[model samples]
Target: MNAPLSLTTPAVSVDIAGVNLSYGTNHVLKDVNLAIEPGEFFAFLGPSGCGKTTLLRLIAGFNQADTGHVRIGGRDITDLPPWKRDVGMVFQSYALWPHMTVRRNVAFGLEERGVKRAEVERRVETALGLVGLAHLADRRPSQLSGGQQQRVAVARTVAIEPKVLLLDEPLSNLDAKMRVQVRRELRDLQQRLGLTTIFVTHDQEEANTICDRIAVMNDGIVQQVGTPMELYERPANLFVAGFLGTANILKGRIVGSGAERYFEIDGGTRFPIPEDDRIPDGAALVFRPQHATLTDQAGPQDGALSLPCIIANREFLGASIRYGARIGATEVAIDVPFQSGKYLFEIGSSGWLKLWPRSLHWLSV
Candidate 1:
C-alpha cells in the first residue's frame, strides 16, 4: 500500500477575454468573454451546438481561438500546447485504457510527464483513494461499473494536479439514478480539492444543482450568466426565459398611455402595467406555470390579471398536476399542487387564469 498523499493545491482564476473562434465561415464562437473565479464551481450550460464544448476545449489548449486570449492565474497561455497547459479535462466518454489496470491508468499522465516512478505510484494510489476506488486499483476498466470508470478517469486527471479542472458532460453516459449519485460525488470531490472547476452540460437540473454559477449559451453565443435562480427568475430575453425552465410566454401589445398603460394579449387579457415596470416594445408576457391560478370569477383580484381560458389537457406529475390552459389561440401551462381530496379540473372546462403582476416577466424574442 502507498502512503496517503496531501492534495492542498492552490486555486487559480481562469479568464477569457474577447475570445472568438471560427471554423472557416461557420463562426463557432462569438466575441465571448468570461471571468471564472478561483475555486468556483462554474458551469457552461446549453443545448448541443452552442459552443460550450468549443469554449471548454479552448481553455484546455485543444482548440485555438481565432482572436483573444485565455489567461490562467494571471498568466497568458494562449500559445501553450496541451501538455504545457496545466489544465485537466475529463471528456464525456470517460476515455480509459481497457487493458490497463485502474492504478496504471491513473499513473499514465504522471508517467508521460516524466514523473519519478515512486512518486507516480504514490500519486496514483492517493488519487484512487480520494475517489474511494483504492480497493479496486488492480481491476481493469472493462471490469468496473460506469460510475467506477468515471471515477478512474477523474483520478487520472487529478493525479497530475492540474490548476483547473474541465469536465465536459462527464455524467452523460450514466443512467439517470447514477447521474444523480455521481454528480453529488463529483461536487463533493471538487469542494474537497478546492479546485477551480468548470462543468459543461445541457441538463438544467444538473447545472442548477451542482454549479455555483452558469453561463447559458445558444446559437454559439452566450445568452446569459448568473445563478440558476437568478437566470430562472430574471431571464434576459425570451430565449433565456424558455430555455432555463418551463415558461409560459404570450405575445402582447402595450396599450393605453402614461401611468394607465395596459398590456393587451391576443387572448383578450388586459393587464395593467405598474409604473415601476418598464415594458419594452415587442416584449412578450412571460410567467412560470405556478404563477397563475384557475378561478371561476371573471373579475381580477389580488393584483393579478384575469384571463379566460379552457382546460385543454392534464398531466399527472408526481407531486403536482400540470394543466394545459388555452387562452384564445395560445396555450399555456398551469401547475396545481396535488392533494387527496382537492377539486380537479376536467379537460374542456372553462375557467379564468388569474396571473399575479409581480410574478410576470417582460421578455423579447
Candidate 2:
C-alpha cells in the first residue's frame, strides 16, 4: 500500500484588512477585516447576496477588493494574480474536466507549474490516494458519483500544495445523507492536512459543525464573529440573535424599577426583570425556543420567568416537540424533548411557559 500523505503540511495565516467591494452602484462587502490563524478551519456564513462567497473569491484572487489589502502568512498579495498567490479554491460546481482521467485532473495544476515528470507522477498518485480514489485514477469525471467528484476536486486543490485552501459551499451539490457523511470526511481530511482553510456557506449547521470559528455576515456587514457556542448562546445583537438560530423575540416595554422592576409585553403579560437600570424602557427580550419549558402550572420558581400562555400549535418532530404559544398579544415558540407517554397539551390548551431569567437576552426594539 502507498504511504498516506503527511498531515504536517505547511499551514499559513490569512489576514484581510479594510476590504471593500462594489459592482457599479451595488456595494457588496464593506470594511471587512479578519485575521485567521494558521490551521484554523474558519467559516464565512450568511444568506445569499450577503457577500460570503464574494469574500472567499477575494481571498482566492478571483475578485479584487476596491479598497484594501490581503496578506497570506504576513506577505502582502493584493496585487498578485490567482496563480501567484499559492491558494487553491474548490469551486462550487466541482469544475472537473469531463474528458480527462482523475489522475490527469489532479496533476494538471502541477504540470502547468512545470514540476518535473517524476515528481508530478508521485504527487498525482499521492493526491488520489489521500482522497481514497487511487484505484479510480484512470476513470473520467463522468464515471464518479457526486461525493467522489467532490473529493476529486478537493484532491486536485490539495495536490498543488497551496498555502491555503478555499471551499465555496463544496458540499451543497450532494444529497442530504451524502452531505453529512462527506462533510465529516472533509473535516477529517482538513485536520489531517493541517491546511489553513476557509469555508463559505449559508447553512448555519454546516458552519457550526465544521468550523473552529465563524464570522456571521449580513448585508455587507459582519454581524458577529465567534465560536459556534459563543455565537449561538451570546449573540451580539438582534440580527445575530435572530440569524444564528430560532429566537423568540418578545417586544415589550420595561416598566417599574428596583426590586419590583419588570418588563411588560405589549399584549398584557409581565415578566420580572431583576435589573432594569441598564435596559431601555422599550426593548425586546429574546430566548431560544429550546431553553423554554412548557408546563400546565402557574407557580414561579427561583431564577425563572413564568408566562401564562395557551398552546397555539404543536409539531411532532422526530426527536422533540415544538410548540407555539400565545402570551398576551405576542406569540412565542418553545421546544421540548419528545416523550412517548408524556402528557402533551393540545392546540388552544391553557398552559404556562417557563424560561430561566439567565437565559433572557435584551436587545433594542
Error of 1 at 362 (Å): 0.6
Provide the clash count, candidate 1. 0
Q: How far in Å is the alpha carbon of 352 misplaced in model 2? A: 0.8
**Candidate 2 similarity to native, TM-score:** 0.96
TM-score of each: 0.97, 0.96
lDDT of 2 at 219: 93
Alpha-carbon lDDT of model 1: 0.91
- lDDT tens digits, residue span 1-365, model 2: 66665543468999999999999999999999999999999999998999999999999999999999999999999989999998999999999999999999999998999999998898888888888999999999999999999999999998888899999999999999999998898899899888899999999999999899999999998888899999999998888888898999998787777888888887778978876336754678999999899888788876678889988999999899999999998888899999889999999899988998778887876
- Regions more than 4 Å wrong, model 1: 1-9
The Cα local distance difference test for each model comes to 0.91, 0.90
lDDT of 1 at 80: 98
